[model samples]
Target: MNKSLLKLTFTFVALLFGLNTFAQDDFQGKAYYMSKTTMDMDQWGGREMSPDQKKRIEERMKSFLEKEYILTFNKSESIYKEDEKLEAPGSGRGWGGFASSFTGGPKYKNVKDQELLQDQEFFGKQFLIKDALKPLEWKMGTETKQIGQYTCFKATATKVVDEFDWRSMRRRQPPPKKKDSSETGDSAKADSDDPMNEIEVPKTIEVVAWYTPQIPINQGPDDYWGLPGLILEVNADRTTILCTKIVMNPEEKEDIDKPKKGDEVTQAEYNDIVTKKMTEMREMYSGRGRRN
Candidate 1:
C-alpha cells in the first residue's frame, strides 16, 4: 500500500473505534433526593388549637412532613419522581387537610428544548402541567465543597413565587383577621412572630444549591435547575432536597418519558386554580366554624 494511503486508513479506523467507545459509555444517570418540609403552625396554634391539639397535628403528619424522590436523567433530559412512600391517609383535620392538597408528581425537563412537564394531582383530579422552564440567574461562588466523592460548587439565586402557592402545601396566608373595637392596646395587634403577617402572598425565596461539575448536567430535583452542574443539594422556601446518593449510567435505565395524563395547564394557570380551590375550602371550613 502507498504510505499516505496506509496512514489515512489507520486514522479512519481509530476514529471509528473512538466513536464506538463514546457511544457505549453510558451517561444515563440516577440521583436520589430527600425533601423535608417545615410549616409555621402559628395560625393553627394560638387560641385556635391547644397544646394537645398541636401535638396531635404534628404526630399525625409525621409521615407527610418529609418526602423522598429519585431523579433519572441523561445529558439533556431528566425525570424526577417520588420514591416509595409509606404515608397513610390523612384525616379531615388541621394541616391534615393539606395531605390530599398537594402531591409532587413526576416532573420531566428537557434542557435541550427548554421545556417542562409536571404531573400534579389535586382532590383526585390529575393535571399535566406544561410550561417553559423558568429562567434562573444563578450567581456562581468561588467556594467548593465535597458531597460524597464529587467536588461541588456553590450557586445561589432568587426565586419569586405566588404567596398563596399550594404546590408544596406550604403556609398560605389566610383572610386577614378583622379588628375588634372591644379589644384595645398591643394585645389586640398581631404579634410579630405571626407568620401570616410576615409571610404573605408574592414572597421572595432564596435558592442555595451545590452542584458537582463532575456530573456535567443542568438537572436537579423538582423545579430547580439552570446550574453549571447537577445539583446535589438545594434549599428554598424553608424546604431542602438533598441528594442521598447518585448512580451514573445505571444498569437499569428507568424510563425518562414525559407523563401524558391529566388536564393540561401552564404553571401560572395551575397556581391560579389551586389558589381558587384552597380559598373555597377555607371559606367552607370557616362557615362551619361560625355555625358551631
Candidate 2:
C-alpha cells in the first residue's frame, strides 16, 4: 500500500477498535438505589425532630446528589398518615399520626454528573474510557453479597490531602473577597483554612459494584460506570449506596434529564451550606449536657 493509503487504513482500524472496546464494556440496565449513611449527628441530632427530619434528610441527600448526576423520575409522596382525632387511653389530645410512610419509583442519576460534581464547568460532558483505569493504583478486591442478586466487586481509591483548598466549582457559594471580614474577625476565618482539623486524605473509600454484562449500556446507579456491566453496588466514604431492585428493559420508556440552567448552583456555595450544617450537627452532639 502507498504511504497515504497505509496511514488511512491504520486510522480506520484504530477507530473500529475503539468502538468495539466500548461496546464490549458497556452494561445497560435499570437499578433501584438506596443510599445509607451513618447519621452525622446522634439520635437527638436534628434527625429526631419528628417525622419532619426524614424529609429534611431526603432533601439534603437530593441536594448532595445534585452536585453530581442527572436525576430521573425523582418523586416522593407520603404514604402513612395518622388520625390525630382518635383519643388515646392516657394521652390528653392523643398523639398525631406520623406521616413517615412514603415510596418513590426508580431515580436515574447519569454518570456524567459525577465528574461535574468534582468540578462544575465540566457539565454536559463525558469522560474517556482510559480515565477510568487511572492508578493509585487501587486494587479490585473480593466479591461480596449484595441484595442477594449478585456478588459485588470492591474497589478502593485515595488522594493526598490538600489544605486551604475550596469547592467553588462544586457549589454556588459567593466569591471570597480579597479582604473579607466577618463579625468574628480573622481568627475564625483562619481556623476554617486548616485541613488537618477537618480530616485526613489518602483516605480510603471502598466501592462495591455488581456489573452484569447482559445489558450493553455504559452506566451505573450513581456516579459509577465503565464497568463491564451494570453496577449494582457502590459504597464511598461514610455512604453505602446499593441497588435494591433491577428491571431489565421495563415496559415503560423514559428519558432522564440533567440538572441544568437555574437548577444548577456554584460548587462553593453548596459546600458552604453542607459544611455549616455539618458543624451545627457536630456542635449539638458534642456539646450535649454542657451548659453554655
Candidate 3:
C-alpha cells in the first residue's frame, strides 16, 4: 500500500479502538459552517440587465444564497440548523421570500437508528418530514489535506438530486426554433404566463467531501454523513459548505431534539405537496394574466 493509504488505515483502526473508550453521553461537538452558493447571472437574463439592476437582484437574494449553520452532535444523533439572524426591513422580499418557504428548519439525524427528521414551514403550515437517512455509497480516496487543525481525507459520491432542492436547480434552456412560425407567438405567450416552465433541476450531482478522523463521529452539516469521521467540508454542485469553527464538549450544550410541531410526512410526500401548491399558484397567476 502507498504511504497515504497506510496512514489512513492505521488512523481508522485507532479511531475504532478509541470509540469504545470514549464517553458517548458527555462527548459532544458543535461545528459552525458557512454555506455559499453561486448563481449564474447570464442564465437568468443578466446580459440584458444593467449592472445596477443585477446588483439589486443579488442583494435581494443574498440571504438565500449565503448562510451560516451550526451542527451539534453526539455519537449517534445530531441537529443541524441555520444560525438565524434578524434581517433588515424589506430584505428578503422578492426571490428570497419564494425560497424561504422551501427552506426547512432544524434537521435531526440519528445515525445509529438510521433516522432523519426535518421541520419545514410552507405557506403558513408546518410539516415534519420523517424518513430514513439517505445513504451515500462513498468512494474513499487516500488523498490527504489539512483543514484548520485537523488532517482530512478525501471522499466522493454521486447524489441523486432532490426535485425540490433549489440549490441544484437552474433555468431551462430555451426551446429550439421551429420551421413552422404559425405557433411561435402562442407558444411564447404561454411560456411567459407560467414561471415554473423556466426552472429545471438536474437528475444528479457530484459531491466532494473532506472528513477528519480526529473527531471520530459520523456527522455532517445538512444531509451529508456516513463518513468514518466528521465531515469538515462539502462541495456539491453550485453550493459549498465549509467548517469555520468547531467546539468540542462545550460547557453549555443544547439538546439534540427532533422537531415535532408539524404535520408528519415523508420526504416524497412533502415534495408532492409543494409541487401541487406551486402548480396552483402558476394557474392562478396565468388566469390573472388572461383577465388583464
Write model 2 residue lDDT over 99-183, tens digit each, in one string: 0111111222333333332222222322111112122334444443445555344455453222212211121223475565553
lDDT of 1 by residue, 1-292 (tens): 9865664454456445534433543568899988887766774453588889887777766566677889999878899987865445563244544654565478899998999998878787889989999877999775777888876778899888654554333434555766755655443332332333434444577889998766667888888898757899998876888999988677777778988999999978988998798667656655555456
The prediction achieving the highest lDDT against the true structure is: 3
Question: lDDT, candidate 3, residue 139?
Answer: 99
RMSD of each: 9.7, 15.0, 2.1
Task: Give the clash count for each candidate.
Answer: 2, 12, 0
Residue-level lDDT of model 3, residues 16-91, one tens digit each, is 7658745566788899999999999989899999999999888888988999999999999999999988889767
The lDDT of each candidate is 0.73, 0.38, 0.90
Higher-ranked by lDDT: 1 or 2: 1
Q: Give the residue spans of candidate 3 off by over 4 A.
A: 13-21, 93-95, 180-188
What clash pairs does model 1 have? Answer: 163-201, 163-202
Q: What is the lDDT of residue 179 in candidate 2?
A: 68
For each candidate, what TM-score against the reference? Answer: 0.74, 0.40, 0.93
Q: Which candidate is the best by TM-score?
A: 3
N/CA/C clash count, model 3: 0
